[model samples]
Target: MNLLKRFAVPVACAITALAMTACSSSKDERRTPTPLTQFKPAINVERIWKADVGKAGRYLFSPIAVGDAVFAAGAGGTVAKIDGKTGKVVWRTRLHTDLTAGVGSDGTLTAVGATRGGVYVLDSNGKLLWKSNVAGEVVSPPLIGNGLVVVRTIDGQISAFGAETGELKWVYHNRAEPLNLRVSAGMTFAADAAVLAGFPGGGLAAINLKTGDDYWQAPVSFPKGVTEMERINDVTGAPALVGAETCAVTFQGRVGCFDANTGRPIWQKPFSSTSGVAQDNSTVVAPDDWSVITAFGADDGRQLWRNDKLKNRSLSVPLLFGPSVVLGDYQGYVHFLSRDDGSFVARVKTDGSAITAAPVLAGDTLVVQTSGGDLFGFRPR
Candidate 1:
C-alpha cells in the first residue's frame, strides 16, 4: 500500500510550498513572497552570542528555557544546556540515538524523545537518569513537571512517566483523525496539575499532568471541507495559556480562546494557521498560512491590525516581547514589529536557514534556533 495514501501527506508539504514560493511554477501572484520594505529602525538589536547545535533533519526541534539556562536538542542526538545570558555551554549530553523531539526541562530534569520510540530523562548535571519506551513516534517535546515526564506521540497518545524512574504512569488517548498533520504540536503545563495540548481535528484538552486524566476538552475548529486534504484541521502548535484563558490555532480551521477551567469558548475567529498564537494581557497575535501576521484583541477577539509584508515567508509563531511582536521567517530573518501598530521596527538576519521554531525569550535575551542548528541570542538596545 502507498504510505502517502494511508497516512496522508504531511503538512510539511504545505510548509515547503510556502517556503519555496520563489521557485513555484504556479501563475498565482499571491504565491510570491512580499518584498521587504524599507523601514527606519526604531530599536537597536545586538547579537549577544551564537552556539551550534546539531541540525534538525526534516523535523522541528525547539529549545526550552528554564530560569537562566536554555535546554536544546538536535536530530543528531546532541542535547546541551546553554547559559541564557552568556551563551556558554553549561552541560552537553549526547544520546546514542537520533532525537525526534526534545529539550523540555524544569531546571532540574530534562526530557527528550528519541526517533526509536523512547523518552530520555537527564538530571540537572547532564547525567542520563533513565529512558522509557512509548507507544508511538514522539514528535512533541516531553513535558517534565509534577515528578512526571509527559510525552505526546504522533499517534494521539499522551503518556506520563515517572520523571526519575522512567516508569509509565498512565496513558491518555486523544480521538484520532483519519488524516492529521505530522507536525510538532507540543503540550504546555496548565494550572500546576494539568497539561494543555491541542489534538487532531482541532481539539484542545487539559489533561491531569500526574494521572493523564482529562480535565476538559474544547473544540477550536471543526473540519468542513470535502476533500481529505481540505479537511485536515489539526491544531498545529502548543496552546498559549494566560490566567484562566487558553488560546490555540488550527490548520484550515479557526483561532479561538477558551476558558481554561470549563472549556467554553471565549471567542473564536475564522483564521487558519500552521503555527500557534502568542498573546499578552491585551493582544493576541498569529501568522496565517501565507505568513500574514495579524493581531487581535485578547479580550473580545476583535481584529486590531495586520501586517502582510511577510506573506509566503513561512513565518514561525509570533513571540510577544515587551513592546514588539517578534518572529522568524524562512530566510532566517528575525523581525520585530510594533505591538500597537504592526509596523516593522527592527530586523536581523541569521545564517540564511529557516527558523521553524518560535523565538523564545530566555531571561532578557531573545533566543532563536535555525534549522541548520545555529542558536543565537540577541538583546535589544
Candidate 2:
C-alpha cells in the first residue's frame, strides 16, 4: 500500500483524552512525567499508510488484531473488520447500541461487552455468533477458559456463564467505592487452572472455567489512604505475566507485579514509575513515568537503561515493530526507537491526534487507532 506523508496535518481531533482519561485508573499519585524532559534526543519516523476508516476503540479500549484481521468499534454500535494489510473493511455491522472491542480465546473469536449490558460474539470471518443479555452494562471484556465465560459490568459485578450454552453460571458482587474507575474488572494468572477474575477492595478471586467454582482468591492490591482517589482502583487491560511474575495495572496509577504462585508483590511502581511495559524474549522494557524508556532485568526488576526519547502523556504498551520499540504519544504520532539505547530512529507523522490504544503488529502491517476515529495502518517505507 503506497502512502503519502501528512506532517503537521491539521486534523480536528480531540486530544483532550476525556475518553482515554476515563479509561485510566482513578488514582494518580504523582503527575505523569512529560516525555520532553527526558535525556533522550530526537528520533526519525516516516509515514506509510494513512486512511480514515472512521473507527477508533479509544485508549485502553480499542482496535485489536484477531488472527488475520483487525476489529474496531464506533459510537453507534458500529463494528468493522479491516484487512490486516490492505486497510480494507472486510466486514462491518451495526449492533444498535455502542459495543466495545472484544477479546477472547484467540484473535479468531471476539466477545464484546456492550453499554446496554449485553455480551455479543463474532466468528473469525466477522459473523455474529450470539448476543445475550447477562445482567449489567458490560464494561470489561469477557474471559474464556475451561469452557466457561467470565465478564464484569461497569458497576463492578462479575458473572460467569457457560460458554457453550450461554447459560448463567454464577454471579459475584464487588462493592467498591465508585470514585471514578473508568473500568471495572481485571484478571491474573492461575497455574493450570483458569484466569482469576480480580475485583475491588483488593478482592482477588478465580473462577474455575469448567465448573465456575471459586478456586483461589486474593487481593488485587492493598490500598492505604484517606482520600477518595487513594482508596479506589479500577483494573484495566489484561495482566501481563513476566516469567514467574504476574503484572497488572490498577486505576489508581500503580503498576504491580506479583508472584503468580504466592500473590506476592514482585515489583511495584506508580503510574509515574513505569506506566506500561512490553516483554520480549529477553528484555523487560518499560516506559518511565517521567520521560524515558527503561529496560529492567526481568529476573529482579533491575533497571538497565533509561532511553529518554519515548515519553508522552500516557505511555502505551510498546509494540516491537521490526527492530524498533514502537510507542505512540498523545499527539497522535508513532515513534520507532532503538530497543537497545532508546535512541530515536524513525517517526511517522500520523494524524497528530493522541493515539491512546496500543498498536497492532500483524504479520507485516502496523495498525493504530487515533482519538478522532481514524484507523491508520503503516508499513516500513
Candidate 3:
C-alpha cells in the first residue's frame, strides 16, 4: 500500500542463519510463463460489503478475509468479525494489544509481538483459545502452517508456537547489526511446503514453519551512502505466490522472485514503482515514480511491456486474477488490462479515492478498499 521497505528495526546482525530465501525469476531472462491458453470471467469491480473497521492504531495492519468471515483489528485492540456476504458484524473481541493475524479455514493465531506480549489463538466465533508470549515488537503478521503458528518481531525474533495448546515449540533469535531493518510491514506468504517471511537488512528471508529452521536468505544490499531506508520506504507489500514460487518487492522498487524454499534470489530487476509489485498468473506489474504501469514475465525477469498510458498518476499495485490485472489510480479510476500483453482493457472510475493497499479477491468478487476506507466490489459486467 505504501512506497517502501522496513530497514529501521534494531537487530544484532546484518544476516542470520535462521531463515530461508525464495528466489523469483531466476530461470529465465526475458520470457513470460507460457501463455495459459485459458480464460475466466472478465474482472468486474464489485462491492460486496463495506464497514468502517476504523484503522488499527498499528500502521501496518489490513483487513483480512478468510473462509466466510472478514476479520479486522482496530487501533484500540478491538477485533471485529463481519459476515463475508452481509457486511454485518458477527462478534467483536477485545485484546490488550492490536493484532496482526494468520487466518485459515480452521481458525487463526494473532500476535502482540515480543514486547507487548505473546501470540493468541482465536476461534471463528470470537473465542480466545490460548496465548503464549514471545520476545520483541511484532510488526509482521502471524503465519499459520504445519500446525504451528509462526511469529516474527522487530527484534529479529522468530518463534514457532503450538497452534492448539499455546506451547512454545522453538525460538530462534538472530543477532543483527547496529542498523537492523525495521519490519513495519510484511506477511507470511506460503510457497511450496513452506511459509515465507522477512524483508529485512538488504534482502528477504524464509523460515521453515514446521521445525523453526532457517533455509536460506538473500541480502538486498544497496550502493554506498544510498541508504536503502531514505530511498526505500516500506516492505509493506505482502507476497504474491506467482507461478511456481512466491514473490515480494523491496522499497528500492524491484520485482523480486525467490526460490520460495531457500530464499535465494533467482533474479531481480529495478521495477519502477512508487509502490511495489503486483502479479497475475502471467505478469507482475507496478507503477513507478513517473506513475507508469509496467509488466514483466512472471517466470523470468524480462520486461514484457510498459504502459506509460498510466502516466504521472499515483496508482495502487496491480490486482491479478484470471485473464486480467486491475489497477486503481489516485484519480480513483480503476483500469482493467489484458493479461496476455498489457493491451488496453476497460478503465472504470472508482469512488475517486487514492488507492493504497493491493486489491483483494473474495469469491468471484473483486474487492478494493480505498485510502479513504471506501470498499468497492465488482463482477463481470
Candidate 4:
C-alpha cells in the first residue's frame, strides 16, 4: 500500500482490499516523490547500534524505550528487549499468534496486541504474564501506564485491563464516523491523570486513565466536503502532549492545540497531515499530506518554515531532537533537518524499507523501526 495517499473506507472493510483498490485506481494522478540532493553536512550522525525483531507484515509497529532498555515487536509474534547503549538482546519471546500492534512498555510490564483481538502482557524478563481480549483489532500500541493496559481497537472501542492480572476493568466507546482512514491513530499520556487520544471525524478526547471517565472532548477539525471521501477528516497519529497544552493533526483537517486541563482551544491553523506533529517549548513541526514538512509557532500558531524537498516520499512522523528534526523516509533513509530553517543537515541509510512509525528518543539516542523489522539507533553529534 502507498502510505502517501489517504486510504479512506468504511469501518466494516477495515482489513480488506477495497481501500487499496481505490487508491491504486488513481495511481497515475499521484505525485512523484522528490529526489534527494547532495548537501554539506552540518551535523554528524552516528549509528549507535542495530537489531532486528521481525518483519511487520501489514501493520505499523513502533519500538518503545523505557530507560536504557528498548522494547520492540514484529508481526511475526516476536518481541524482544535490547540495551539502548550496547544494542545487545536481553531477552526475546514469541507468542505464536500474529501481532498487529505492539511494543508498549513501562520498564516493568510490556504489552502487545494481536490481530485476533488478543492482548498479551509480559513481564520485564520476557515471561508471558497473562492474556486478555478486546472487541476489535488493535492497530495501535496499547497505553501502558497508571497500572492499566489501555488498548484501542479500530472500531472505536477503548478497553482497559489490569496490567498484572489481565482482568477487565473498563471500556469506553467513541462515536464512530461513517468513513474513516485505515491508519493507526495512537494515544498519549497528558500531564493530568488522563489519556489523550484522537478519533475518527477529528475528535480529540481526554479520558481518565483510572476510571475511564471523560476529562474533556474537543474538535480538532470538522468534516467539510460534498462527497464522503472528501469529508474524511480522521486524526492520523498520536496527540502530542507538552507541559500544559496538547496538540493533534487530522488527515484532511486542521492542526490545533488545546489546554491540557480544560480542553479549550489555544490556537489553530489550516493544516492537513497524514501523521502527527512534534512540538517542544517553542515550535510544532509536522509533515503535510504531500510530505512537505512545516513548522508553526507553538504559542500563536504562526507559520515559521516549510521544506518541500520530501514531497510524496512517505516520510514518518517528525521527531524534534536537540538541534534537528529527525525523520525516516520510504527508502529507509534517515534525514536530519535543521529545526530552525528546515534544511538538510545529515542523512543515513538503513535496510531498504518504508519507515512508518515515528522515531523515539531513548535517553539521548534516537531509535527508529523500519517495516522490514530492522531497528537503528542514531546519535547526532
Estimate, for each residue in 1-381, the C-alpha lDDT of model 3 and write its tens digit.
Answer: 110131111003332101111111144332111211233435545545566554433233445555555555544455666666666778777777655432222235433332364566676567787777776666555666467767767655677777777788887655443544333334554532444554443455665555666666665344234653344322435566654455666544456676555556767886533345665555667666455667777678688877666654555667776777687765566777787777655666566655545665556656655544445555655
Candidates in order: C-alpha RMSD to true structure: 6.9, 9.0, 10.3, 6.4
Candidate 3, residue 71: the lDDT equals 59
Instruction: Compute the lDDT for candidate 2.
Output: 0.57
Instruction: Estimate every model's Cα lDDT from 0 to 1.
Output: 0.84, 0.57, 0.55, 0.83
Evaluated against the true structure, the overall lDDT of model 4 is 0.83
Where does model 3 exceed 4 Å of error?
1-44, 96-118, 174-184, 189-192, 220-223, 226-236, 261-264, 272-275, 289-291, 308-315, 328-337, 340-355, 370-376
The parts of candidate 4 lying over 4 Å away from their true place are 1-11, 15-26
Per-residue lDDT of candidate 2, residues 1-381 (tens digit): 001121111000111223334224355533343444332434434344555545445423556675557777654466667777777777776676676534443455566677667887676666777677866556555765555567777555677766666788777666645453444244433433545555544445544555555655555556667875566554444555544555555544555555554566666655422234565445556564343566665556666667755443565557766678787776776777776766776666577676755677655778887766777877775
lDDT of 4 by residue, 150-217 (tens): 89988667998888899888998898777776677888876327778998888998887778888788
Model 2 residue 273 CA deviation (Å) reads 7.1
What stretches of model 2 exceed 4 Å from their correct place? 1-60, 100-107, 144-149, 183-192, 196-206, 213-215, 218-220, 242-244, 251-254, 269-276, 287-293, 307-312
Q: Any idea how many clashes model 1 has?
A: 0
The number of the candidate with the highest lDDT is: 1
Tell me each candidate's TM-score: 0.93, 0.75, 0.71, 0.93
Ranked candidates, highest lDDT first: 1, 4, 2, 3
Clashing pairs in 1: none
Question: lDDT tens digits, residues 1-381, model 1?
Answer: 111121111002223324333346266787777778888999999999999889988778889887778999999999999999999999999999999987799899999999768789999899899988887888888888778888988866899888889888999998867777767888877646678899888888988766678988889999998887778788888888777677899988999988777788999999988777897668889998888999999899999999989988888888999999999987899999999899999999999898888888789989999999999999999
Model 1 segments beyond 4 Å from truth? 1-29
